[model samples]
Target: MSIVFEPVRGRPNSGGRLTVGTLYYGDARYPIRIEDRALAHLKIVILTKLRRNESFALSWEKKPADGSGRGTVWIHPALSFHFEFSGSKEPEINMAWLEKMSESANRTLGLRIDDEPREGEADPAAARAGV
Candidate 1:
């Protein structure tokens, strides 16, 4: 199975920016709110999980404190997937994977494999030299 992210609405606000999105798993739809903190945490978790090749389930309920709506997301850790963040608006958060997600949710969520860094890229000395 795969997951898809589609941005329905995006706007900046006083407290913070809000990303109103839709997550798709088959016929089911899950509304997603990507707060700045939540997005940061999500990126870390995704990258770490990909690095270790460890699979785990991610289940969360979407119950807004403001009472817009409620939904749920069931993510199969082992499944090949990608998360695409797509919309006309720019977000305060910027990350490589997040950028790809915006373009095409399916492409981001279906990532079963990720390439390891090049020989020099992983080396601290080389990285320091800007190689």
Candidate 2:
């Protein structure tokens, strides 16, 4: 089954900007459980493209046992969007991963979501760039 992540416009606070969102699967909607840092990174990537009137595909691998290979969605600026957060605090952003994901979104093949970033992982474009 495909899931939809809706971005919520959060209120500003003394600490920093907060972004909260939700993940919708099937008939159920759940408050996004992603780390605030990662969620923020995704927000920037998505909004940047949308603001530029760019449309791109976002793909994520499916659970192996689910028998589905991957899930993808076409994101566009004209579409209605929202981001909602359940908490008041924000997590530290991971600049490396954000950069990697942003690069992937710019590639001809489109963005492909992978496991959360880890130390020493090769640059995401290395494989696609044939370097």
- How does each model score on lDDT? 0.39, 0.58
For TM-score, the strongest prediction is 2
How would you encode candidate 2's per-residue C-alpha lDDT over 1-131 as one tens digit per residue? 33333223322345564433454322333232333454566778888998999988766654555454656667777666555455566655555577777889998778754445665666566656887
- Per-residue CA lDDT of candidate 1, range 1-131, in tens? 22222222322345455543333343344344343333443555555665676544344333344443333343455544443343444344434334333222234333221222232334444456887
TM-score of 1: 0.35
Clashes (candidate 1): 14
Q: How many angstroms is residue 5 displaced in model 2 relative to the true structure, after the best TM-score fit? A: 10
Off by over 4 Å in 2: 1-36, 65-67, 119-131
Global Cα lDDT for candidate 1: 0.39
